[model samples]
Target chain A: MNISEERAQAWRADLRSSMKAKERTEIPRVHMPELDAEYRSHSRLEEVNLGLSAEQAMLEAKRCLDCANPTCMEGCPVGIDIPRFVKNIERGEFLEAAKALKETSALPAVCGRVCPQEKQCEERCMHLKMKKESVAIGHLERFAADYERESGSISVPTVAPANNIKIAAVGSGPAGLAFAGDMAKLGYEVVVFEALHEIGGVLKYGIPEFRLPNDIVDVEIQNLQSMGVHFVTNCVVGKTISIKDLEDDGFKGIFVASGAGLPRFMNIKGENLVGVMSSNEYLTRVNLMDAANPESDTPVFKGKKVAIIGGGNTAMDSVRTARRLGAERALIVYRRSEVEMPARLEEVKHAKEEGIEFWTLHNPIEYIGNEQGRVTHMLLQVMELGEPDASGRRSPIEIPGKTELIEIDEVVVSVGVSPNPLIPQSVEGLEVTKWGTVVVNNDTMQSAVPIIFAGGDIVRGGATVILAMGDGRRAAKAMDEWINKKS
Target chain B: MNKIVSKEYFSANVIKFEVEAPLIAKARKAGHFVMVKVGLKGERIPLTIADADLQKGTITLVVQKMGVSSSKLCALEAGDFITDMVGPLGKATHIENFGTVVCACGGVGTAPMMPIVAALKKAGNRVITVIAARTKDLIILEEQMRINSDEVIVMTDDGSYGNKGLVTNGVESVINREKVDLCVTIGPAIMMKFVSQLTKKYEVPTLASLNTIMVDGTGMCGACRVSVGGKTKFVCVDGPEFDAHLVDFDEMLMRLGGYRDIEREENELYKEALSSK
Candidate 1:
C-alpha cells in the first residue's frame, strides 16, 4: 500500500472512533494491552504491548484537550513538547508528532518505553483536577516514535553550516548524546569518545533488552550520527587520551559526560564470594556480549534458584531477566517494605506478573558456600520498617533472632554505583568531591577549569536517564554562549 | 602523551623506561614509586622509581615480568607507549646521617635500591651495598650499585655468583664485622622479614619497602592498606617504605594470596585459548 493511502485509512479509523470518546478525567488512565493470540501461547522477549491501535491512540489524544498553558512540559526534564505532540497525534500526523518529540529528546523511543510519565508529565495534567483518567501520553508518544522507525524514513532536524568549532564529549550515553546533538545543530563539530567497544554507555549495558531493546537504542544513535556527530569507541578519555591532550588537539571546549560506572559493594562478610557479582558486570555481560548464549566466549552463570538483592528498577530488570534465562524460581530480596520500593509502580506490577517472587523485609547477611567453593545458600535477616530517615522513607530495622536460610545458586547485587574516578585523577587543578565526582556549578555545568564542563552520573553519582539529558541541554547552551563571547 | 626520556634493558625479563614527568621527577626521592598501565584492559601495577633525572624531567621505572600485565609491558619496545602512567606516589624514603648504612637488594630490588644507596652516600654516610638473586643470571644493576656505594657485595642462592648464600648471609657477615648504624632492605617479604629478624639481634635500625595490592594508586580506594607500627596505614599515601621491624608481614602475605586461585584459572584459560589458535 502507498504511504499516503495507509495514513488516510488510519485517519478514517480515528474519526470513526471519536463518537465514543469519554469525558475528561482527573487521574491519568493506565492503558491496558489486549493479549496477543500467538504471544500468549509462547513466552519470549518480544514486546508485551502491541501498542495502542490507531483508533485508541486518537481517542487518547482527544482526551488531552490541549491546555492553553500546559504545565506538563515543565515537568518533563528534556522539555519535550507534550501538548504539541499530542495535538499532532489527534490530527493523525504521527510522523510530525515524532519530529516534535525529537526536537528535544535524543531518545524518545527509550523514554516513551521506560520513563515514569505518571509521576512527571502526566501528573500535572489538567484532567486530573476532577479525579478522572488523564490522557495516555506515554503510550501515544511510543506509538509515534515506533511508527517513524518502522516507516524507515524519519524526519531529521536540519543542521546549520559547519562553523569549524570543535568540541569533545567524553561519553556516549544520554547526556553526551544530547549535548552532541544540540551542539551539532548550532554548527559545532562534535566528536564523542566512548571507553567501551559499543556506544550508549549505560543504556546498552546496564538495562536489559527485555525492557529497553538494543535495536531501539541503536536507532536513536543512528539518528544522532545522521546529524553529523562522530563516535569513536574503545577510547577511554582519561586514560587513552587525557583532557589536556584534547585541548591540544584543537578542541576548544570539552563536555565530560562520562556516566558513573563504578559499582559499590557493601563491606559485609561473604561479599567477595564467587557467586556475588555487581549488577553492572552481570548486565553488561548479558546485554552487550550475549553471554546468555552457551556458544559465546563469556558465558554467564545460569542458576536454577536466583536471588537478586535490591529494590530499584535495575533489581526488577535483573530478576525478570533471570526468569527468562530459564531459572525455575527468581526472587527480589529487599530490606524495605513494598511501599518504599524505588522501582516504578508499573515495573513492580510487571515483575509480579512474570512470576518473580518478592521477599520484602529480608536482607542478606552472609552467603554460605559448599565444599567445592560455590554459593549454596544465603543467610537473610528479617526486618520491619521504622520511622522515616533523611530520605523521607521509613528505614528498615532488623528483628533480632529472625534469620532464615534460603538456598540459591546465584546472587546479583544491585545496591548502587559510584562515579568513575578516571577523569578527576587525570585532570590536575580540577576539584573533585571525596566520592570522586567532579565538582561543578549547580546552575552552570562548568568546572574549576573554564574550558571543561561535566554533568550526568559523573556529577550526580546516579540519576534517571531524563535527568542526565536535562544536564546535557544545559551544558550545551552554556558552552555555546561561552564560546561565542570569546570569539 | 609524554615522551620517552630514556630506555634500557637490565635483563631478559626487566626493562627500565624513563619518561618525562616534570612534576614527579622534581619531587621524587629514593623510596617513591609510580603506577602505570600499558594500554586499555591492562591492570594497574606499582613500580618503584629506580632513578630520576630532574634536569631532563624524567622518572625511571624498572619492571620485572611477574604476571600477565607485567609480561605484556616487558614485550613493549623502546618507542612504544603506555596508555597511562601517574605519580611519584607513596612516602619518600627517610634520609638521615647514621654513621654507617648497609643496603640490601634482591632480584629486581637492586634497581630501586640503587637510588637509595646514591642518596645515602650523598648524605655523607658510609654506604655498603649487597645484591642477591636466585642465580647469576637474575642479578642486575651490579655496576650501577658499585658506582653509588663505598663497598658492594653480590650473592646468589645457587652459588653461581659472588658469595654462595642468601642476601641475609651478607648482612650477618657485615653486622658481625662492624657496628652498622642503620640497614635498608628491599626484596621479597620473606627476605625482608628474616633481614629484620637478623638485624634485631645486632640492635640496628632496619627499613624495608612493602609492596601491597593497589588499585587507584590514590588514598581514595583504600586498597593498598598495611599495618605498620600497630597502626593501619594506606600504602599509596602513607608509606610504601616503612620500618621493617614494625611491619605486619604475616597479614600482607595472607592478603597477597587471596586472588591466587582466580589468577591461576585465568592464566590457564588464556594459555589454552592461545595454544588452540
Candidate 2:
C-alpha cells in the first residue's frame, strides 16, 4: 500500500479541488478502520482500531475545511496546530504533518488512541457546530504519526545548546514524559525517575494493549531517549533518595508528575471477600502482572461469573479483559443509566458486541462469599438517576427494599482512584490538599517548594492523558522561565 | 533478568528461591527487600532478603503462597528466570553493640531474623532467638537460627515442638535472667504487638520489622505507608524495621488485612488448579 510521490501529488491536487470551504462542507465524515468485533472479543490482546490508510487520512484531512480561526486548536489541550498538520497531510506532505504535531504533542500516537477528541477537537470543528460531521482529527493524527514511525525516519526536534542545566522529572507517565520531552528540547540535562520496573507510568500499566499498545509507547519513549532524555527505572524520587537529596545533587528544577496510581475500593459489606478486588489490582495483575498464565508468579482468578462494577473506562477494560479470560457471564453493574456511563461510546459498543451484559440502575450492597471466603454472589440494590450533582453527573438514589442477587465469582471495583501520595507525604513543607493532591500554582505548576513543581494526577487528582500532558507542557514552560531567570 | 539457582518448597505454600543476583547479594543487608517481577508482564512484588551469599552472588527469598503475586512466585521452579529484581531496598537494621539481643521470630519472620542474628553474632553480641509457629511443620529457619544465635528457643501453639506456649514465655524468662539490651520481634502483627507490650512492661528497647503492602520496593508508591511515632512512614523507604513502642500496629494490622478477601479467593483458585495438575 505504498503511495508513490507522483501519484500522491496527483491525489493531493484532486483533494485540493474539494478543499474549498463550500466543497469541504459537502464531504462526509471519514470512517476509521476497526478490528472485527467478533474476532477481537475472543482475543486477549491487539489494538481495536486498525488505524487509517494513507488515502483515508488524505480524505479526512481534506474535510477539515481549513478554518481561518482554527477553533480546533483552542479545544486541543497541547494546542497542536490542527489545521497546519491536516492541511500538510492533504497536500501530500505526510512527514511534515508529523513534524508539525511533534512541535506541540509529546505523544501524538498515544493521544490519537486515548484522548476524548469528540468532546474536544472535533466538538470545536466548524462543521460540527453547524450540525454537520467534523473532520476525523484523531484518526489523521494517528495516521501521520504511524506513517512517520513506520517510514524509519523519526525527525528529532532541534535541541538547544546544553546550558549545563539539570532538571529531574519524577514518574514517567504522560505528564512527566511530556515535561521531560520539552525540558530535553530546551537542552537541559533531563532525567526521568520512575518507581516501577517499566517506564511509561500509566501508559504502560493502566491502559490495556488493545487501547494503546506498548510498542507505540516504546517509540515515543525512544524518541525522548534519543533527544538526550535519560530515564532511570526502578528509582523512586522520595524513598530511594529524598527530594532534598535531588536538590543537593545539583538538580536546578524538579517536576513531580507521579500520577494517580492508588486504587480505591467500595466500603461495602463482604467487600473483603476473596473474589472481590479493586479494578486497579485486577488490571495490574492481569494486564501488567502476566496473571493469565497459570505458571506465572501472579495468576489472576478466571471466574465463570465475573461482575465488573462502575461505568468508567477502567470498568469497561476490566469486563472486556474478564471476557478474554473466559468468563461465561461477564457483566457490568453500574449505578447510573447507560447515558451517564463515563466509558467511551466505542468501548461501550465494543463491550456490547462482545456479549457483556449491562445491569444499569444497580449498585452492589454486599458481596456474598462462601464459608471458605470466596465471593460467590453479589447482592445489588436497584437505583434510579436523580438530579445533576456537583460533578455535573446525575446522582443515583438507591430504592429501598429492592434487592437482587446474582451468582458471581469475581467483582472488579473500578469506582475511582486517588493521586499517589508519595511525593506530597515524603517531602517536608509541601502543601497538599485534604484529598492528598499536591497544591501548585495553576499557571506555573510550581509548588511551595520553589525548586519543585508538580502536575498530572498529582495535582489534578486524576485526569485524561491529554489533560495531564497539557499540564506537563505548561509546567515545562514555567519551569524553563523560572530556571532561566535564576541562572 | 535473573536465573533461579535453586528453589525448594518449605511447606505446601511456603517456598524458598535462591536467585543469581550478584549485585543485590553483595549489597543487600538485613531489613532490605527486593521487588521481583516474575516475568515481563509480572507485577512487582516486594520480597525481603531472607539470606544472601555474596561469594555465591545469590540472594534467597522465602515467599509464602499467600496472594496472586506470591502464588505465582511459588509456582516457579529451579532454572526459571525472573524478569526484574530491583533493590536491597528499605533501610538496613541499625546494628550495634546492644550488649544482649532478644530475637523473637514468628512464621516467615524467622527467615529475615536469621541474617540479623548472624550479623549480631559477628559483631560479638550475645543473641538469644525465639522461633514460633502454629505447629512443628510450620516452623522454618530453625537450623539457621541455631547456627546464628548464642542460644535458641522454640515455641509452638499445638505443642508439636519445644514449649507449648507463646514465644513471650521464652522472652520473659530470658529477659528476666539476662540484661537484654535490645529486643527485636519479627513476625505477624499480633505476635509483634504482644511482644511490644511484653517488652514495655520490662522497659526494654524493642524493634519490630514490618512487611507492609508495597508496589514499588522503591519509595515512589505510598502503598507501603505505616504510622511510625504518629507520622506516616513508608516501610519500603523509611523503615521496614521500626520502634515497636511508637509503631502503630493496629493500623498496620488493619491495612495488612485490606486485601485478604481477594487474596484468599485467588489462593483457593490457585490451590484447586495446582491440585488438579
Candidate 3:
C-alpha cells in the first residue's frame, strides 16, 4: 500500500476498535508480578521485577482505550508511536510491537525498566480521566521488548545505502549509543569511544545489577553493533585522542556525550574520610568491578551501618545496595520531605519494602570520623518545609538548635553531579555554561563548533535515561541534516 | 590493545615493562601517567610513565606488587596483551632551571622521578638525587640516576647502602651544605609528608607528585580528589603534582588507605589461589 493509504487504514482500524472499547475499559489494569521483596532484596544478581507473562501482557494491552489523539505519545521523550505498539500487542503480534518501538527508541528494554512511566506516558493515559488506574503502558512495553529478545527473533532496523561519512561519539552511554544507532541507520560510519572498560556508561556502573541487569544492556549494545557501529573501549576522547585528532583522521562529525561522571559531594566537614564516598564510587565498585567478591582486585568496604544522603534515584540505589552488602542498618537521609523527593515512586516504595529506613526532613550537617579516619557518625539537622522553591518543591529550612547524632560506618553522597569537564575544557571554542555544560542550539543540539554536538547527562547535567536518549536521537537528525547540506 | 614487548625485574616485587602505544608515547611528558587494566575484570589503576621512546612507539611502566591489580600487571611476560591502557593523562611537570634541585624519592617513587630528573638536568639545573629504600636490595635504577644526576645519594633504612639514615636525613644534609633552590619528592604519602615539612622549614620551593586513588584517570570519578591550599582539586586533571606547602598530606594518606584492609585480605587470598595452582 502507498504511504497515505497505509496511514488511512491504520486510522480506520483505530475507529473500528471503538466497538470493543466498553469491554476493554472494563478490563482492569494488570498488576505486574514481582519477586518477593524480602527474597529479592538479598539476591543481588536477580532482577526484582519478574516480567509480565504473555497472557498478562495481552490482557493489559486490552486495557488501552486506544485514544484517537493518543496523548501518551506526547509524554514520551523519544515520541514512540504508542497506539501502534499497544494495538500490535492487543492483536498478539508481539514482535511487531517491538519493531514499532524500535522505530524511535534505541534502548527500549532499558527504558522500559528504568524510565519513570508514572510521571510520563502512564500519567497521560486516558483511563486516568475516568478515575481509574492508568493502563500499564510501561509494563506492556517491557513485555513486548522482552518477548522479542527472548524469542531469538530480534530484528535489525533497516539502514540506508552506505553514505560512508565518518562520525564519532565520545561516550557509550545511553545518549551516545542512541546517537550512534541513529547515525548508523542513516548509513554513516559511526564510532563510539568509551573511557571505561565496559559499554553502557551509567547503565553498567552507576546502576546496580538487581535493578537493571548488565545482560539486558549488552543485548541493546549488540543491536547497535549489528547496525555497523564501532566501539573503542578504554579510550578517553579529549585525553587519549583529541577532538582535533578525530578531525585530522577525517571524521566528519563528533557527538560529545561523555556524561556527568563527576559525582558531587557535600562540602561538609569530614567528607574526605575513608568511609565516605560518592554513590558513583560505591556503585561502580560493586556493579562494574565486582567489588563484593572478596577476591576481586578492588573490594568495597562492607559496612554494618550505612547512611545514603539524598532523595534521588541514585540515593535509593545506594541505600539498597548497602542493604545487599550486609548493612545491619540502611537508611536514606534526605533534606526534604518524602513528597518532594526526586526518586521514582516505585523506587521509593521498593526501598521501603526492603526495610530501608527513611529519615525524611533530616539533613547531614557534618560527618564525624574516628581517629582511624573512617566515618563513625553523622550530625544531622532537623529540617521543616517552607515556601515553594524555584523547582516548585517546598524548600527545606533547618530548625534552630534541633540536631541529632547517629552512628554510621559508611556514607554515600548522592546530592547531584556536574557535567564531565573533559570535552568542555578540551575542545577549544566550544561554548559552555557556568555549570560546565556545553552550550548547544536547542533545535539542533549543535555546539559553537559546527562539526560538534553534545547530549545526555553532559548536556542536561543530571537527567533520566529516556531524556538522554531523546537528546541523542535529536542530535543524530541534526548532524545528518547539517552534513548532507554541507556536502 | 597495547602489547607487552619486554619485561624486567627491578627487584623481587618490582617490575618494569615496555608496552607498545604509539599515541601515548608521543603525547606523554614527565608527570603524565596512564591507567592500565590487566584483564577484563581488573580495575583501572594509575601508573606513571617512567620513560617513553617515540621512535619505537613504546612507553615504560614500572610496577610494584602492592595489590591485586598491580600484582596481575607484574605477572604478565613479554607478548601478553594489556586489555586496556589509556593515557598521557594529568598535566606535565613544570620544568625550568631552578639551580641546585634535590630529587628525593623512595622505593617505587624513584621510577616516576627519573623523567623529572632528566628534564631538570637538561634544563641546566644541577640535580642532586636522593634514592631511598628499606634496604640495599630494594633500591633500583642506581646507574641511570647516577648518569643523569650531578650527584646521587643513597639512603637505606637498614644502613645497608650509602647512608644509614632516612631519606629526610640525606635531603636535610644537602640543604644545610649548599644553596638548594627547589625540591621534588614522590613516594609513600608519609615520606612525602616529611619531605614537604623539611623543605618548608628550609624555605625551599617543593613539588610533591600525589598518587591518589582514581577510577577513570580522565576526571570522571572524584576518587582522586585531594585538598590543596584549602580547596578541593582533582589530581587527574588539576594535577598529579602540586605545591608541597599547600597539600593536606594527612587527609590524602587516609583516603589512600581507604581500601587497605580489603586489599590486604584479597591479596592474601589471591596468593593462596596462585600457590595451589
Candidate 4:
C-alpha cells in the first residue's frame, strides 16, 4: 500500500481506539461554569455555554466515524465538507478544519455559532442508527472556527485578477455579505450599501449579543473587508438612490438583500398604547444602543412586568432581553404549543433554563391602559388546540368564557415581519406580491428587472441566517452566469 | 440617489425642489403625494407633488421646514441628493364637473391645493380659491392659484393681505352671495374641521386631504392610518385625500400627537446642534 494510505489507516485505528476508551471511561459530564457571582445576570446574554474543554473537544471529535460518504455534507445548506473537517479536528488540525469550512461558507464562525445543526447536519449523522449520541458536530465546528480566529490563522480565499464588472449589493446583512464575498472572489468589484449606521443588518440590530457575539460578527465583516469588498453605511438604496439611478451610476448589476425590517403587529384593540412596540424597535434599542445602560442617550423604557407575544426566535430574544432589563416577571405569551413553536430548539431550551415563563395557549385580546395612556395590563383569551391548519400545525381556537387579566407594563409584539416596500414602491413596474414581498424567480433569485436581483428575508418575509446565506450563494452563481452571458 | 435639478425658496421656511423621477413624474397627478427621506437616519416624510413635468422627467415638491425631519431635509443644498423618494402614492384626487368649486388653502396647504384647483377649472367648473395664512408672509401659491382659478381671494388673520379674517370668513362671504357646488380644503385639522362643519350646514360636497402619521407611504406599515365613516383606512395607500365630512378628525389629531415626545427630543437635539454651531 501507498505510504499515505498506510498513515491514514493508522490514524483511523487510533481514533477508533480513543473513542472506545471514551465510551468505557466513567468521567462525569463537565458542566459549564456559571457567571461571576458579582455580575447581576438573569438574562441568557451572559454566554452561559462556556464551550467544551480541549479534552472534551477531542473526545467529541473521536466519536465521528469519518464515514466514506458522509450525509452531513449533503444536509448542510452551504454543502460544507463535514466529514473532512471533522476528521481534521480529530487530528488536532483545527486551522485546517476552519480553512476547509471557509472554502464553502463565507461566515463559518457566525454560522457555526448560530446554525441549528440538530435539524440539519447532525440529524443525518450515521451514528444515530446505532442508538448512540451523534458526534458533537456543531460544537466542534464552532471550536474550529473560533480557534482559527483566535490563533490568527485565517486564510483569505484566492481571488482572480480584477474584472471590470461592478455590482451593487443593497443591505449589509448575511445574504449581502455572502453574495459580496463570492462575487469578490470572482474578481468583481462589489460595493455593499447599508441604510443604517451599522454594517450588519439584523446581525447588529435584531440579534442580541449573548447568542452571537458582536465581536464574532465584526470579525466576519473584517474578513470580508480584507477580501476587497467595500461597504458604505448610511446609504438607503431606494430612498437615497433609486435602482434606475444605480444603473446610471455605472453599476452593471444589483443584488438587494435589504431584509424584512418592517415589523408587524396584531391589529387588535389598544395596539397604539404608549408601551406597545414591535420587536424590531425593542431589539434595535437594546442591541444597537446600550439601552440597558442608565447613562445611554437612548434609554428604553424599563418595565417590571413584561410580556413578549410570539413563538419565534425573536420572541425568545425579546423575552430574555426583558429579563435582563430588570423585569420582575418576563413571560412569553404564545398561542401555540411547545412542540409547534417556530423558534430554534436551542433557544427555547436556553430560555426555559434561564427561568423565562411560558404562557402557552393564551392570546392577548386587548391592552388596558390607565388614564395617563400607559399600558397597565393585557386582557388575554385562553385558547385550545383544534384541527390542523394549512400549515399542518394545530390552530389555537379561542376558548369561550375563559379570560384572564395579566399585569404587564410593556408588550413587545414579535408576531411577524413584512418586506420593506421602499424599493418596490419607488421602482415602477417591479411586480410585488400582495404581502409586499419582491417577486423573484425562486431558482435564479432574479426579479422582474433583469438587472436587479433579490433574496433573503426581503423575498421570504422572514428566514434564518443559514437559509439567507444559501440564497446569497444561489444569487451569486446566477449573477455570475448573467454577467458572463451579457459579456 | 435621486438627483435634484433645481431648488427655489417659495417662502421664508418653504422651499421647492425639482427632482429627476421620471416614473413618478409620468404617473403623478394633482393631489398626489410622495414620501421622501433625506438621509439614512432621516424619517420618512410625505409631501404633496406640487407639479410634474413629464417631458423634463422631474417632479416638484414644496416643503415647509417644520419638524426635525423637514429641517434636516431643508438643510440640503441645491446639488445635494436625497436617500429615498417614493411616490405618487395615496389615491389621486377625483375631479369632475362640480358646477362651482371653492378651494381653500392655508400656508403650505396651498402647494397641495394648487393642482386640485387647476383640475377643477379644467373640468369646466368655475373655480374660486381662497389662499389664507396668519399673514401675507405665510401665504404661498397665490400666483399659481390665481392663474388656475377664475377668481382667487387672499386672506390673512392679521390684516396683512386682501381680507382681514380667517379663511372661513371669506368662504362664508362667498357662500352667502352664491350657491357653492363643492368645497375642497387643504390645511391643518382644525381648519379643515371647521370648513367641513360649515360646508355640512350648506350641504355642499367637501373633500379634505388628511396628512396623518405615515412611515412606509404604503399600506404595509399602517402607521398613517385614520378612521373614515366608521371604517379604518390607511392614508399612505387608501387616501391622503378623503371626504372631509366623513373623516374622524379627532382620532387623527390624537394619532398625530402620539410621537410628540420623540419629536420634542429630536427638536431639542437640533436646537442644541444649531446653538453649538
Minimum summed lDDT over a 10-residue window in model 3 chain B is located at B214-223
DockQ ranking, best first: 3, 2, 4, 1
Name the best candidate (by lDDT): 3
Sort candidate 3 into its docking category.
medium
Candidate 3 backbone clash number: 0
TM-score of chain A of each: 0.93, 0.95, 0.97, 0.93
Off by over 4 Å in 1: A1-63, A90-92, A130-134, A234-242, A288-306, A321-329, A366-377, A407-410, A425-436, B1-277
- CA lDDT of every candidate: 0.78, 0.84, 0.90, 0.80
- RMSD for each of the candidates: 7.5, 6.5, 1.9, 5.7
The list of candidate 2 runs beyond 4 A from truth reads: A1-18, A293-295, B1-32, B38-43, B49-83, B87-103, B114-128, B133-277
Candidate 2 structure quality by residue, lDDT tens digits, B1-277? 7889999878887889999987677667888888887656566777789899878889999988767667677878899888777777777889888899999998888888878998898888999999988999889888888887999999999899988888888899898898999999998888999999999999999999888776555544355666678666667766889999988787677667656765676668767887999
Q: DockQ of all candidates, in order?
A: 0.08, 0.20, 0.69, 0.12
Which has the better TM-score: candidate 1, or candidate 2? 2
Q: Which is the leading candidate under TM-score?
A: 3
lDDT of 3: 0.90
The total number of steric clashes, by the backbone 3 Å criterion, in model 4 comes to 5
Give per-residue CA lDDT, model 3, range B179-217, as digits (tens). Answer: 999999999999999999999999999999999998877
In terms of docking quality, model 2 is incorrect
Ranked by DockQ, the better of candidates 1 and 2 is: 2
lDDT of 1 by residue, A1-487 (tens): 3322433465445543554434433224547573442332124355655678777776678777565567777788888878777868878888988998898888889888888888888888777775665677788888889889998998777788999999999989889998998998889999999866578987887777767788999999999899999998646676546788789899989999988655666555555445566676567657765656532333356778989999998888788778777777889999999999999887888888777899999999998876444677989999999999999999999999999999998888888777866677778988899887889888779999999988899999888888888899889989999999999
Model 1, residue A475: displacement in angstroms? 1.5
lDDT of 2 by residue, A1-487 (tens): 2222322455445655654677777878888788887788767778888998888888777787665577888899898988778978987799999998998899999998988898889889999777788888988999999999999999998889988898999999999999998998888999998877789987877788888888999999999999999998766676556788788889989999998755666667766566676777677666555567555455467888999999988899899989888898999999999999988887898899889999999999998877666789999999988999998989999999999999998888888878876677679889999888999999999999999999998999878899999999999999999987987
DockQ of candidate 3 (2 decimals): 0.69
